[model samples]
Target chain A: MGLYFVAKRFGVFLVIVWLAATLNFFLPRLSGDDPVANKLMEQASLGGYAQAGIAEMVKVYNQHFGLDKPLLTQYLNYVGNVAHGDLNYSIANYPRTVVDMIAEALPWTVGLLGMTTLVSFALGTFLGALLAWPGAPRWLQWFMPPLWALHAIPFFLLGLVLMWLLAFQFQILPIFGGHSPGAKVGLTVGFVLDVLRHAVLPSLSIVLVSVGGWALAMRGMMVTTMGEDYVTFAEAKGLRSLTIFMRYCMRNAILPQTTALALALGQILSGAVLVEVIFGYPGIGALLFQAIQENDFFVIQGVVFTVIVGLGFATFLLDILYPWLDPRITYRRS
Target chain B: MSETILRVERLRVAYDHPRGVVRAVDDVSFSLRPHERFGLAGESGSGKSTMALAILRMIKRPGRIEGGEVWLGDTALSGLDTDRMRALRLAGIAMVPQGSMNSLNPVVRIRDQIGDALADHGVGLKGRALAERVRDLLAQVGLPPDVARKYPHELSGGMKQRACIAIAICLRPKVIIADEPTSALDVVVQKQVMQTLGRVQQDLGAAIILVGHDMGLMAQFVDRLGIMYAGRLVEVAPIRDIITAPRHPYTRMLIESLPSLEQRGGLRGIPGLAPLLRELPPGCAFHPRCPAATERCRSEKPAVRAMGEDATVACHLA
Candidate 1:
């Protein structure tokens, strides 16, 4: 059973990656203008390529970018280039390859965003469980709504507000960028401390912004699971409240969240794209933003494809892990 | 003389709903002696189930025991906090709930679930002794010892009920409450399950409270019977008296409605639905349906009046 699940999920992963890449190839260019036209318009306004006529400019740009070739040829070559880790040069950053630029920014974003998402989800679930506990303090009822209200506010607004209060006004934390201006990057303890210090505000902003949603979801799930007859039976069996909450209620409650967690894993990658940009963290979201502005098609495609692949892989892992957690699930073809 | 194991005095369980304060169990009281089989017989919405839940302090949101003192031995169940109530459950007063066959965890093997009950109660026995005890419990319920290794879904319905019974009685508490324990089984299987329960009680000397709607089954299995209607016990009597000489008009109708095998006749269902608690008729809740209801019965509620050592009837005429 385990082997079959793993194999099926792997197959799904491949299909999802292929579909994402195919969609990426066309969706960006479908906005009723050719890439060369946008490029010509920009360059013409700058007077760098005004001497060239529209037709001639299109031809020259196409030849330069290998778009002069047939569509099939360009697609096949692009696929080959991707496989060989030879993503083309950025149109905006004429000297930098798409692969190199994304590689430079990927780890920073992943480290900051990934760690924060996990921490916030755990904290929210714990707090929600506590709040849902019978005879919880009256103060918590007053406290939870504001957190939920904060969750409804967009990430960018929250990020800007935090930046204004904590960074701009109070001068309590640094305003922008991933690291301090002169901080050295090395295997030294001082370097690690500087990196963490820089990370603290951005991580906190993202965590506070997202934690309430998880808390609400988990608490709702706990309430529903608590109503299940088995839970009532467990309580009546004279099990300790702590044991009943953890063992029976949590086991059942956490089942539905497994699917949510699977979807969240995919979301966690791109869900904070705006926040990463706002904080000036060197993550993929910021890289993608920069690449899009530069009309670096290769880099944009690479980043999107990579995100899709990561999401696919996470979903694959979810499919395999769920049955282990919930023994009641049986895989059958309909 | 049998020792009194439970005493519910002037018990009333009500729900504070938006419609009104609805009393689901109105001024009900009963006492069960040690080693007695006391059956509570009533149809759905009769409040017998509510009374059972109230006794365990398991009545959830909206429903509250407004006025009552449920004494299990000497501990007042309504007054006990959640922690004490939990400790009292299973170890002090075990229950076999309705649809209990579906209550066993579908994924867990039967033995592990039983072992969990034992372990949670801190029984602390292990190795051959634990295994022997589990096997003995399984055998006592008429299931083969090997069946304990299987999941609930793998077992037949009757076997699942048996497994539930085994789990209920595993700790050997003084009182066992079986709510519709045999309702889901075929007649042959029902008899077998009831007989198994009888053997267990005989061996352990535990007081039993069997709650079901089937008067015939209760009559066959229980020593005393309590008849409930619209959230109140309208009558309480020994099995012989309740079956032979029922006093309440509703009780007489219910007993008369039963189809006797020896008497060749079609069974007659009671004429009207039981009165809703929200819009109970003025005076006696059953007057609207009772064929023998008088003008006074329609105007004033009846109190349960003493009749004999074994019986009490709630009716204006009585």
Candidate 2:
């Protein structure tokens, strides 16, 4: 990869993020329902109050949120604010900024989903490689059907089942939430251990469901790679079985798998929505879910924009790392 | 050193398919003297490459070494365990694989590719020593020392083939099998690579079994030649004898098929296609294609018998 290539890829990344942010800004507004007005109306009806002065309240709220301005002006202001890392404030949770909410939830999402995705990728890739390898144990073939079954089921559904079996029936683990209800949030070992304990069921469900996909993809790649002339030549060179398996077979096969992993990691924020909701883990997915239910446009926009940037960043890193992974991949303009 | 460095005794290789077992290499026997160049020439699907792979005990799945033993020096390759066989490979008997374009790992540097072969076989060279050895190997193959730092894709087709040859000779194996090693190269580069191969074989005092369909190349490079038809070696003789007074009818046709400056005429190819291994003709596999096929040649299989001190032919007419 060259400097020019890096610059070109970075330029593309910026354009993509900007396009995504613009789409995010316009999509919800196109729904034609004023989330602020809707929230106020729902609140008034729940409290059994008259709907009088609702128009006045809506106008006041719109002005305060800078929504009273022309569309272009509002778009410009939104882009500027986003550039400065200010996501304004949540519509439903008025006093709380979207940035604040995201900051609190981002770590949990990254910790849980990030860890699970990597573990599943590594474990699944190895298993998949072994599955296709002729020398692998015969018993490994037995893992195929069960893995496919687990992969077919949605992670949230798997989470529910695991929760029902382990948490509800046997009570072997915490049923929901990120930690014990009364535990203090800190860097203490006890607190960390408690968080990990709560993370177990959600991570298990995710790892189980996703591992099969990685394995299947890896196995396909491995099979094709195994047929490559280089692998045969490597064997003819009399390399150790382990060396051949790792360097020649798995090394080449893992290139496409790494690309998938980067994409998967980028999608982790949005993908964790259902899993986090089920586990009651305070991650961005759960935050986005709560924001959607309450019609908090700022939080939704903030979360979505963050995911777009993350995905673009992931691909950008992939571009930078690609030349290293496979020497044939040159980023030269030609 | 023994008179014969590598001896392949009654080697048989079969592929198990849904329809039937395809005998790719059937009871083929040959041997190589030290510092000798033995060429195995045959048309496509004639089990020449299979015999070469079987010699290395590298017949892949669905294909098994059904019978016979490959003896490199005094050691029987079949009796040894996989680790032992692997150890013997590149150390005792290395192979310059066919399809050199994709033989070297595309991502790996030439130096590492060579170094790994050395390292795996317990060469124990590291850092500067390994680097120097790799450069030396590259130089010996007529490649620039800088090629050691380049990846396979960075090198040209001929360069890649030379790199493969470099790797094959890295361990100074007793026998090197060049299986159509220059099949993918043009005539010019093919000649250069073969010369490089010949030079390396001489330097190492190792015998070479050159497997290819090019009779011209075999005649030029090899001391002796074996003609394979279907799944059998129909003629095994000195190159000069095989080319000048070919014994088997198939060998005669193969020699005649080669274009010559001396006789300018229409090209002549063998009359029929090589028989399918699964359903070979009842007699000699070459009988259908043989120009001098007789009633006995069509009905009875001819065992390989010595016709003279220097040659053997599996033809009843001979």
Candidate 3:
């Protein structure tokens, strides 16, 4: 059943990616400048060519970049390149393949953002369940207002404050970067420790700024689940309060959040571009930002395609797993 | 006389409302005998459910028993803490709640829920023995043995009610309280559920307290009947007397309001709603709505008076 579902969703996923790639090929041309014209403008800006020389330059550039081919033939070649795991060179920046550039930066963003989100989700959900218990302590209820205040604060501002206080004032840790200046990259424990040390400040900031939202969301889920008749029935059946909390309430309360998590998974790969820029993390978000500024169309297309495919896969996996986690759900093909 | 299993004496349950203390159950009392089916018949807001919860100490915030001793055999249930009360409840005295269709967890199989109650008491029954016992319970409730393997959602409304009954009786408790167990089912299904209850009570010989608004059904099944009007027990008598020789005007009206099986239409419902607990009238709560109400009935609340044949009526005329 699981294999069949995965195969079916994969078919749909491929069709969606194909449509998106087709759009990518046509969309840049709609901006009203051919690659030959762009090349001509560059030569004119450098003041190195007269009109006749610029025309010769344009012809050479067009032939080299395959802009001389028919539109349909160029589109087919682009699709074939994508199929062979070949993301061509960035158009306006460094001549690195878009694939290699993204691969180099992908790990830093995923490691930082993924770790923060998982930790925050766990802590927030546990505390929310505790607070929502019927006879929960007053202090926990009192804790909610401050958490809400933190939640209302913007993530960027929170990251700035943490960087100033913990890094600048205390001189406790490095403020930015994926690793310390002298650190080497390898499978060694020393390299891993260096990466962890550098990741601590920005990751902690992200977790603190985001944890309150999840805590508040989970508290709401708990409050709603607490009122469900099954919870009451579980209580009436004489299951211990702790067992009821863990088994009955949490199991159901966590379900709606699962979809949110699936949606967030693709976005996590991009990370916070602003935060990464502020902290100098070598991640996809920073590269994407640079790529946007330079109009690196090939790299941008590759990044967008990867993010979309990641989202589709995450949602597909979640949909397949939901029925196992919650027996109330059953998969039906339309 | 059968041995008395539970005695609720001078029970007064009140809630702290915005308008002061609203007495939801006012000076109501009754005793249940072993194997006797005592039915409390009243419309919504009559405090029938409140009285049952009070017996189990299941009433939480806002609602409280102001004056009462709920005696299960010799042990006072009302004074016990929540842990002990929960232990006694369902293991010693269980309730088959209203809306039985929604009572069971839709995700869980029927056998697991029944096993859960048994497991709560630190009892272990597993493998063939567990399956056999669940099958026996299913058969006892007139359900197919394989029905235990199905989820509650797969079952019909009446089947869910029977599943509820099966779970309730799994402990073999001394008292079983069923609140409006058949209200949501079809006529034929209602008969089957009620008959299943009768059969379970007979087989277990446990004291049964059946709460319902249907007077005719209550008359047919219950050995004793207590009629509640506006949270007070206005009359208690044999089912025959309550149905044929009702003393309180409220009881009489309630009985007359129900249609006989032969009567096709025009069942006269009670003219007014049950008195709101928050702002009850100064005298008898039912006086404004009672057809035979006198001047004194609107001026002073009546007290319970013993009639012959072990019956009691709370009315000025009586």
Best TM-score among the predictions, by candidate number? 2
Q: Candidate 2, residues B1-318: lDDT per residue as tens digits?
A: 237888888999999999999999988888889899999998899899889889889998889999999888899988999999999999999999884448988888889998889889988798999888988898899999999899988988999999999999998899999999998789899889989999999999999999998888888999999998888988999999988999888888888888999999999887878788889899887877777788998889999997776578898988
Q: Cα lDDT of model 2 overall?
A: 0.91
What ordering of candidates by lDDT runs from best to worst?
2, 1, 3
Q: Candidate 1, DockQ to 2 decimals? A: 0.45
Write one digit per residue (lDDT tens) for candidate 3, span A201-286.
Answer: 87877777777777778879998987786776666666666667877788778887777677777678665587788888888778
Regions of candidate 1 where Cα sits further than 4 Å from its true position: A26-70, A80-97, A332-334, B74-81, B100-102, B105-116, B124-160, B184-192, B279-283, B299-301, B316-318
Please list the residue runs of candidate 2 whose C-alpha ends up more than 4 Å from where it truly belongs after superposition: A48-55
Please tell me which predicted candidate would have the highest lDDT against the true structure. Answer: 2
Candidate 3, residue B206: CA error in Å?
A: 1.4
DockQ score of the complex predicted as candidate 2: 0.84
Better of 1 and 3 by TM-score: 3
Residue B257 error, candidate 1, Å: 1.3
TM-score of 3: 0.92
Residue pairs in collision within model 1: A109-A283
What's the residue-level lDDT of A159 in candidate 2?
92
Tens-digit per-residue lDDT, B180-226, candidate 3: 88987888999989999999989998989999887778988999999
Q: Could you tell me which 10 consecutive residues in candidate 2 chain A have the lowest summed lDDT?
A: A47-56
